[model samples]
Target chain A: MNIIEVNHLHKKYKAITAVEDVSLVVGQKEIFGFLGPNGAGKSTTIKMLATLVSPTAGTALIGGFDIVKQPNQVRQTIGLVFQETTLDERLTASENLFFHGMLYNVGRQTLSRRMGEVLEMVDLGDRKNDLVKTFSGGMKRRLEIARGLLHYPGVLFLDEPTVGLDPQTRNRIWTFIHQLRQRENITIFMTTHYMDEAEHCDRIAIIDHGRIVTLDTPENLKKMVGGDIITLSVTDRERVKSHIIEKFGLPVKESGQHLQVEVPGGETFIPTLAVDLGERLRSISMHRPTLDDVFLKLTGKAIREESAGAWSGMRVHMRGRR
Target chain B: MRALKAIYTIWLRDVIRFYREKTRIVGMLGQPLLYLLIVGTGLSASFRMSFAPQGFSYLEFMYPGIIGMTVLFTSVFSAISIVWDREFGFLKEVLVAPVPRWSVAIGKALGGSTIAMLQASILLLLAPVIGIKLGPLMILKMVGMLFLIAFSLTSLGITIASRMETMEGFQMIMNFLIMPLFFLSGAMFPMNSVPPWMATLMKLDPLTYGVDALRNIVFAGSPAREFLIQFSMGTDLAVVAAMSVVFITAGTLAFNKIE
Candidate 1:
């Protein structure tokens, strides 16, 4: 059964349209990725599903409850971790989880047990009694993830969950996310601008200009981007390009110092082309299409080109102030 | 029941945060002491030269006002914390919870009021130090009146803070609003024979009745100071209670409008 079903969701703010005709379904325990550049209606759609923002036209069902008609039920069923830090800095980690459980009406008896359970799930068991102010950025994010799960929500919504963390912490968080899916069987619906993160999702919906451009499994989506990319550096690059195009029946585009070729299989194509142009080839490298390539092929722009800041996760090393 | 728990949860967080900041407690308690003991003693000495009533010291007249000042400042700080919460993204977590929006606002008001009341009760301990004897019943009555005032002021603060995005903005606005609320409350002077315009302004200020109610409880034993009480306890309670309802309702409405 699907945990979340969104139908043609739309949102408009006066003269501007934030989300236009967004429709998707997330199956139970599926790791769904809502991939988009900043301000591409990623947050708008997530907020609508979370019942934080009202949809203008379409309706959604979260955990079999209508988002508009039964907002509280939807809220009860979903745990939302916002893009920014939301944990109370003054409170201890356990206290933060306890209050979150209280907000969800988690029973008194169950709350203490779940507090320990969720904290342990996030690997923050030892830091349970420590103040959030004393925590590192990664620890704070883990605690928020812990607080979000204290109520045993059916779906966990993480909005840019790893935007500000270092690569190591991001991997650690992804490990926890996978554990949640495997151990708790909780569906995670996340939005992220990072292409590598999107590669980890069971399925990804690439949204652009407040619309979903494509939705498919990461592998299938990469396949849709079409073929392995093989780049060759040769002294006579133009001559090699003609021989490659004539034999492969494909177009070769010049990419700076290399002649880039796209073929059905890079591993097979590289060996055959290498033998033919053995003495002429200076360098040869092949890579499967990345999500960034997928986005560029579909949207004609790199995802990172539109991202505003390169160091959003600088909170990891800095202890100066929040 | 869930809604009530949500309110309690929010209130608990604020209370925990309040006590955790040890400096805040010291500041809250120290300000009122400076007023009641240092400045108040200096002013009472001049009153002794003029009227010279043994039991009717200026300290007795100003005690309620000092408490009111403390309540006002504490409550406003709590409201500013709401703005801080919003700025720092903590408010988003509360707003997205399954609980109703009104519960969050009420919880904030309760938290702020409870902190203010905590400060007031501690200040109430100083009554004996200032030569004002208070029975347990009087203390209970005083606590109730103080809560009403704190609740209303915190609600008003929330209403204003809800629209504010930054701490400095809320602080700037509260500075413009709090001084008039304190001075016009008749906290420093007896309200019996004020100028007509000043009387009209004091009547408009909600803290005026709150301070008056505190004075009624404090001046019960001394006939000399009792005459300085402007309104009956019932009238003062009614005014502050009405304001409490209005401010809380407005605060809840403001919270509902938040994104």
Candidate 2:
């Protein structure tokens, strides 16, 4: 059963097309990830699904309710955790949950029970009375997750849930997300640019320039990149490039001082290549294909290049925090 | 029932926030008191009214206007919270909720009006110090008039704030409009003796009727009651009620279009 079905969704802002003819389906209890760089129409697609932004064309359905005609029903069936923090700073943890519950028309007794259950799940039970302003970054994220689940929506949409957190905190948030999937039996739809994080998703759609370049499971996507990638730093790059081309008929590209080659089994071919090259090979390394490689192969540009500024800005912000 | 509960919850959040921040009470009340004391006392000696009855002073004439000022400032400034919530991302949460959008606007208007009325009530307590005696009936009438004035002013505020995006821009626009509205409302002088053009402008200003209604209620049994009748109490109330409906409808439409 597909919980979310989007058919040729398109969003246009005046003269610019933010999302161009996008379509996908999210199955029940499936952890679907939208992997893309900044401004790849990822957030726009999510906003359309969440019923926050109306599409220029195309349509979607959530829990069998049309997004355009039945917005209230769609809103009731989906929970959204936005990219920016949305909790009232003046309200306490329990107060925030209570406020959300009331807005969703949850009954008093059920609200109280769910409040305790979510608070305990997020490990904020001890600080329920503390104002949200005093909470740490990790604690705030946890509370937001708990708040998103208070209404018990069947599908939860998280927009970069761990963007600015440290590695440890990011791991803990993913743990909570995985636990929620197993314990509550809810489908999770998330968007992220982190390659390692995308590795955790059951399936990922790599979007670039307002289009999905590829959509497949983590292993299958990596497999699309073919075998291991081998790089050799040799004194004579041109000589080695032609030698490999002549000996094995494998295409070799010269990158600065390094010679790069792709083969079926990188480990099995390294010995003969090294023996033939003799002392000309200064250094050599073999690595399994990662999502970054897949992105580079599909888009012809490294993902890191697209997010370089944001990554550095995040680092500066983190350093200032410490 | 669900709509009412949502409205109540939204209104309660504003009340809780207002009470928790103690400085806001002092800040909201400070300006009205200054206008009443310094301006009232200084102008009283220089300005004596011939239209007023024998013993009525200029301070007495300005009292109701000052109440109108308090209500206007408090009610309109409360809408700035909309811009604040937008900047901080909290407004998106409220906007995306399953409830109807008008309930959010109504909740904000009621909350703002309640706060404005509370400020007006505090000003009402100082009536004795200013030589105005209020009976129970008069006190009830004054409270009722203040609530109407607050509700209308708050609706007007929300209507403007809904289209605004930044706090500074909203405050700048409010400052530009509030002073003109205050002066044109004839809060400092009687509307009966103004120039023809000034009278036309004053009649057009909604706050004028609010001030006029307050003056009528505050001076009902006094010697100036007959002169205050120039602005009919029933007419002022009716105009205010109609304006409230118009402004609220406009506000709800504006809020519904927010993307």
Tens-digit lDDT string for candidate 1 (B219-250): 78776654677789899999999999999999
In model 2, the Cα lDDT at residue A126 comes to 99
Best by DockQ: 1
User: Which of the CAPRI classes, incorrect, acceptable, medium or high, describes model 2?
Assistant: acceptable
Give the per-residue lDDT digits (tens) of candidate 1, residues A1-322. Answer: 8888999999999999999999999899899999988879998899899888899999899989999999989999989898789888888988888888889999899999888888888888888888889999899898888888888999999999998789999999999898888888699999999999998999999999999999999999988868888878998977888998888788787755778777777798788888999899999998889898788778866688677443453344222222
- Against the true structure, candidate 2 reaches a TM-score of 0.92
| List of chain A TM-scores, every candidate | 0.85, 0.90
Per-residue alpha-carbon lDDT of model 2 for A166-276, expressed as tens digits? 999999999999999888978999999888899889999999888888999999999988888888999877888888899899877554456778788899999988898
Clashing pairs in 1: A164-A313
Instruction: Assess every candidate by TM-score.
Output: 0.90, 0.92
Candidate 1 has a TM-score of: 0.90
The Cα error of candidate 2 at residue A50, in Å, is: 0.6
Model 1: DockQ score: 0.59
